[model samples]
Target: MELRWNPILETWVMVSAQRQRRPFMPKESCPFCPGSGKVPDQYDVYLYPNDFPHLMKDPPEPSIQDDDLLRVERAFGSCDVVLYSPDHTASITQLSREHLARLFELWRDHYRAMRERADVKYVLIFENKGDIIGVTIPHPHGQIYSYPYIPARPAKELDSARRYWESHGGACLFCAVLQKELAFEKRLIWTNEHFVAFLPSYADYPNEAHIYPRRHCGSLLDMSKAEAEDFMDGLQRQVRIYDSLFGFELPFMMGFHQEPVDGAEYPYFHFHVEFYPLHRSRDKIKYNAGSETSGGAFTNPSSPEENAEELRKINAEL
Candidate 1:
């Protein structure tokens, strides 16, 4: 099995075809279980360096200098897992405000710790929820990954934002988008003094939502205590609304994008949260068939506007 870098596509393609045939179990013994060898049962939150890392801080072995046409560079980075709660049944959205705040505290701490490493430039925190998303463990947890190089999606966004900032004499692209959504209000779900959740006009999924700090903060790592508290409050409320919309505990992939932890500052970058759910309705699932995989196009069952309206109604009733 090998991983190849596709320079034209600007992505890493895992060349292991057998990986698609790997066995998956919904009830497998979780390696992250407390008192299961690595950690004790009394821990409410656990953070450990991953045994299988995509990148390591240590220098890599000599590269195989094949033909110049087929060059391969080592992708060095680290991956770690964060146990969100002691109770495996609880999800991030199900966490109490206090527990959620503690989680946020750890997030901030991890960001600082990873960024201090000279090899790490970008740090990403995200979660894949439910077995449908290929998450084997039922535990309420997420993963933290630190890369020596900026990731493709974030690098592209940063470039675009930097260009926009230069053109506008220092302006945030996301802040402008947030202003537009606030004025429109049709796509707005909820907001407080510090944060807002809204469905973007150019949403890629039926129920896609973006949560952002109202202030033009660079990243979650830089958020003040008050701002962090308000952000968590809005986050929990949004999750409840999502669950109510489907009349069940909703499943979604949530990720936070922040400025890279490297010493350089990104004045144009604004911290934000993105949630993309696979389900379009109670029974309908959004499957990314060949079109999405091969052509980079999407076909959503419901319009973003309609979905926003439905979400708004549910949020209000809740």
Candidate 2:
């Protein structure tokens, strides 16, 4: 795979033709199952190299020519799969508090380790749940991708946050959003001492939620032990609420938003987790068609207030 620069969009596009051959929903033994021979038995949280990785630590030379407009580079990065539980059918919502705390610690450790690499510029921690989210494996796991450069979305967020900081006298943009949400309490789902989960007023998807730390922190490494516990508490509660909403497992994409490891200070950037659930109702799924895919616009079917009220009514027993 090669990283081709798109001059028009100012982003790097990963061209990995080999990924099409990766395994889909296999009917035989699961690769993530304990003692399946692919993975070891008796492990609380497991981290292993991805069987099909998109990037590498030392990648091949660029395949194409480099010019003023078209530039190509090797995809130098690392990808790791994090198994959340040993059980084959376990879900994040079902994991114990202690287990989830351990998982968070693993996440922090991996992030710090990846950031330590001189070539690594950014680390992304995210999970895609359910078949609708195009997850081939049924195991409860997440993936970490350490990139040589910052991805487009996060770069855009950082730029915005930087501009906000400059204009607002070094105030964090996310912390401001969290404070505003707390004052309104209309879109809030749950809040503890350290963190708060709320359906943002500008949510792009139905029932979309953003969890933010009350204090400003650039990355997971900055979170204290107490803050980590509260963060896990908020995350677990949010997942449970999603499952309880439609009386089934909800398909969603959850990702952590944090500072890049490019060795730059980002006091204006606050760490958070964003959840985008695809389901609009019990049997309906929201598809990102024309506007969302081509026009770069999101057309949310429901209002944030209505969605928050629906989620607020469901008190998921944790």
Candidate 3:
């Protein structure tokens, strides 16, 4: 496990061959179950260290020595899995709102724990659902990764937000985005008192949705008790819409975007959750092919308004 520097792209690529040897366990032998002997005998929610983590506290030296072009360093970080329920069949949508709020609290505490580490630069909380999304474990759960350095996508967002702040007299770029979405209103799917779920106008996927806090906040720690409850409500509704979209469990990738924990100032940064579902429609699946993977260009065949309207109709029924 080591970090290889990509000079052309200016990013650190994690090289962990151990992940290739991960064991795939079926539901009958699932380790995340209550009686599986891998976790506590009984618990509402559990936190288990990843058996095959991409990063760790003590990693071996790099495979190849450092050269003028190729730079290498140890992969020093941690990854852990947050099991949502001991019952093997309960999805996030089925979990009560109170349970989801507890999950959110667990994420916040874990983020705070990782932030205390001087080497940790970013803490990412994300979930992958459905077998098509590469989740072999059928159990409902999420994962947290503490990175030694900020990942590329979040770094780009921070850079853009910072530039916008500096140029616009400390105006926040994300807040501006939320306001624009609210003004358009066509892309909004659902909303509570404290949060809004909408498809961005610049969406790259057909059903891509984002949840943003109505009040400007940098991280989960900034959420009040009311905001926390409302956030979970928004999240649950978002997934409910996903499942109802095609009368089947839809596969999707959900991630939290927040300010870095490097102890620097990022007043312009905002907290949001982005969902990238693999389904383009009830019958079609959206795959990242040549344009997306090779050239970094995401092509959306459908308009965000039409897509959001579809979800809004579902929201109305729910």
TM-score of each: 0.90, 0.97, 0.98
Off by over 4 Å in 1: 1-3, 12-28, 59-67
State the lDDT of candidate 1 residue by residue for 1-318, as single tens digits: 333567678665433343465445455565567766866777767787765555655635524553444545555567788898877677667787788888898888989888788878899998888678987667778899887777788998899999999999898898999999999999988888899899988887878999988889987767888999998888788878888887888888888899997889899999999999889888888889999879988777678878888888887887
Query: Candidate 2 — worst ten consecutive residues by lDDT sum?
Result: 309-318
lDDT of 1 at 193: 88
Steric clash pairs (candidate 2): none
Give candidate 2 misplaced runs (Cα > 4 Å): 316-318
- For TM-score, the strongest prediction is 3
What local lDDT score does residue 278 receive in model 1, on the 0 to 100 scale?
Answer: 85
CA lDDT, candidate 3, residue 161: 95
Inter-residue clash pairs, candidate 3: none
What tens digits encode model 3's per-residue C-alpha lDDT throughout 1-318? 889999999999998888898877865799998777899998888889999987888878888898878889988889999999988889888888778888988999999988898878999999999888889798889999999999999999999999999999999999999999999999999988999999999998888999999999999999999999999888888999999999998999999998888999889999999999988888888999999999999999899999999999999999
Clash pairs, model 1 backbone: 55-76, 55-77, 56-77
Ranking by lDDT: 3, 2, 1
- Kindly report which residue stretches of model 3 are placed more than 4 angstroms away from their true locations once superposed: none
lDDT of 2 by residue, 4-56 (tens): 99998899998887789888857566888888887887888999898878789
Residue 178 lDDT (model 2): 86
